[model samples]
Target chain A: MKKEWPLWEVFIRSQHGLAHKHVGSLHASDAEMAINHARDVYTRRNEGVSIWVVRSADVVASSPDEKAPLFEPANSKVYRHPTFFPMPEEIKHI
Target chain B: MSNDTVQYLLRLGDNALILSHRLSEWCGKGPALEEDMALANTALDLLGQARLWLSYAGELEDAGRDEDALAYRRNDRQFCNLLLVERPNGSYADTMVRQFFFDAWHHLALQGLCRSADERIAGIAAKAIKEVEYHLRRSSDLVVRLGDGTAQSQKMMQRAVDELWTYTGEMFESDGVDEQAVVAGIGFDPVALREPWLSYVREVLSEATLRIPPADAFMQKGGKQGRHTEALSYLLGEMQYLQRAYPGAQW
Candidate 1:
């Protein structure tokens, strides 16, 4: 029987201002190899400057069923948006 | 174009082309999915480098031949790659050890070739060296990890390294064409690459807790002289199948 390596979620930092955005997941034997695999798989075209890899097991994810209760409240809370507070045109670039 | 130049470039192109073809055999057979991607990626890089070198060889020869004609049409005896590149990929451990040796040699060789008095050769070497560097890192890292990781892995790696040691001698072999190419400023001497390659291989093996095979091991030669083992013709049969079956066919 073939034994499988552990899964890692890959995060790639494209440029200075960008965060380490999750690109995809892959299997590797360890953290170091996971990062190496991430570099080869996710950044083959020089698409990233840095990478971060975490074992998929380490992540705590919210359940999909709770999306409406968790996020729908923000959709209706228009007062929370800064644009909802009108300002005079004198404040350009704000 | 001097025939010496054609001969020199054929060695480089054939090494890359044949190794790429070997790695392509691992397409869906890799032990893991990510490893599959890594091997395929390295194969693509070598294939691209092969195209450049073979295409330039065609240009230098000034014959009607092009890259496709040179790569697919040439028979086994006409190929002049280093012997190390053509040995069968025995196992994952053996494959990585083979890659480690070739990667070290290729990386240093390209760094020297980057200074070629010929502009096109230097330019291609400069670009290809980056890919070779990455290949070296990946292979050496695996060599160290697996060599030190477990008893089974270490045993497997040691067996592979010992088996491949004899073939390493051909990488440093030189002849009249090698001398002329270096004198013509279009090629670098492979003998000069030997010490650095040894250092790199030794250091990595040390870190991996593996010992280098004894230097007195019986050495083999002749791949660079258009002489090859029986494995090469079989490789060509698969690689050249399309061009052989469909005359002048294009994808």
Candidate 2:
């Protein structure tokens, strides 16, 4: 049987001030190969200024069973929305 | 002088065109999806460079030909690309080895041309060097990985290096056209690219744990002079088919 390469999750920073956003996944033998694979697979259209890759196996995620216990309480917290805060018209970009 | 410059540009353009065709062969057939994309990207870059060069060649020739006419109408006997680029892409290892060798020379050649006395030549080289630099890096990285990889991979890479080494000599073989271009300050001497090419190849091979073939081994020549192996005829036949049948066909 042909052994398959490990899966890597890719992230891209589209510009200097932008945060790295999860893009996609690919298979590679190592981190360097992962980075190269990410560049080829995800950034072909001038979509990124920087790239980061992590082994998919290393990522942890909350299970669907934990969704209600972890997030249901926050749904009713209207104060978290900050809807009452007034915005200054002078602050354009914000 | 203009004729010599035109010929020099054809040499440059044909190298890119033929190699671009060779690499595009791997477009849907790469060992992996990522590799497929990478090879295709490199092929596109070379094709763009070819258009620039062949377009300039046609302009300098002052003939009715355009870039498409020059590219699709030329016979194999008229092509002046180095013999190395036309060699068959046998295996993945073979393709990578061929790519590594060509990319190294291309990077050096473009670097030299960046200082060309002709503004147009220098401009083309400047735009091309960035893509060629990335090509060199990727191919070099693969060479090391495959060469120092598993026993089977190491053996395959070694075989590829040995097989392709002889063809590399044609890249540095200077001739009358090159001489005229150099004298006219429109092109650099191919002979000057040899030392740096060898040093870089040697360093990379050593790191890859692959043996460097002896520098003085009997070398093949004549591709730049338009005497090519049978491989080029087959390549040109396929590459020119659409134009040959349709005659000025366009999308």
Candidate 3:
């Protein structure tokens, strides 16, 4: 009888200071194997320099039911848009 | 280019072409989905490198053959890849061992070719070096993983090492073709790559908890001279079948 390894979620950081974005998942016997598999599966096209693999079971997620009532208030906030700000003539670098 | 120089370049192309076709044999058959993708992706890289090499060889030949013509039209005796690349892919262990050995040599050879006095070979080598580096890394990682993994895996790996050790010798063998290319500044002497290749491979084997094959192991040769085991003919039969049947058919 064949047994399968656990699944892992792969996150890739393309460069420094950037968040590791979720790429996809794969199976491996351990953390090291997971990272190796992730490198081969995700980074083949110059995709990333850094990888983060976490057991899919360890990840926490909000329920899709929380989509509206728990977060809908921000949708009405027009002030969140950067267009409302006028550029100051002296604030060149910003 | 001298005919020997052209022959040297064609050998490099043939190595990639034959190895790519061998790797594609694992399609839909890898132990895991991720591995399937990895092997296929590797095959794709080899095929792309082969196109560049054979196309350049065709230009050097100046005999009106294009990449397709050179790849599809060539018969077995004309091929000059190392015996290691054209050997059959046995088990998964066999495939990985073959891959690791070839990738190690490929990476080292490309590192030298990047500095070739001939800019065109240097350019192609430099471009392909990155892909080869990743290939080496992936195969080395697997070699370590399986070598250090379960007892059954170690046994399989040990067997693979023993089976493929004989084929490793041919990669370092050079002849008049290589001599001409080296003098013409279009190729590197693969013999010089031997020490570094041994060091790197031994280090990987050490970490993998695998034993190196005994030095007295029987070594096979002659692929560089266009002689191969019967396996290459079978491989080329499948690879060249469509091209031979259709001749000029294209979608």
Which candidate has the highest lDDT of all?
Answer: 2
lDDT of 2 at B183: 89
Give the higher-DockQ candidate: 1 or 2: 2
DockQ of each: 0.75, 0.76, 0.62
TM-score of chain B of each: 0.98, 0.99, 0.98
Taken in order, the candidates have interface RMSDs of 0.9, 0.7, 1.4
Q: What is the lDDT of candidate 3?
A: 0.91
* Residue-wise C-alpha lDDT for candidate 1, range B170-209, written one tens digit per residue: 8888899889988898888988888888888999999999
Q: Write the per-residue lDDT of candidate 3 for residues B1-251, one digit (tens) a residue.
A: 46877788889899999999999999999999989988999999999999999999899899999999988988998898999999899999999999999999999999888989888899999999999998999899999989998999999999999889999988887788887777877788888988899999999999999999865568999999989888999999999999999998898
**Candidate 2 residue-wise lDDT, B45-84, digit = tens:** 9999999999999999999899999999989999999999
- Residues A1-94, model 1: lDDT tens digits: 4478889999999998989999999999899899889987899888998899999999999999999999999998888878777789889887
Q: Report the lDDT of model 1 for residue B163.
A: 90
Candidates 1 and 3: which is better by DockQ?
1
TM-score ranking, high to low: 2, 1, 3
Residue pairs in collision within model 3: none
> Which one wins by TM-score: 1 or 2?
2
lDDT of 2 at A53: 95
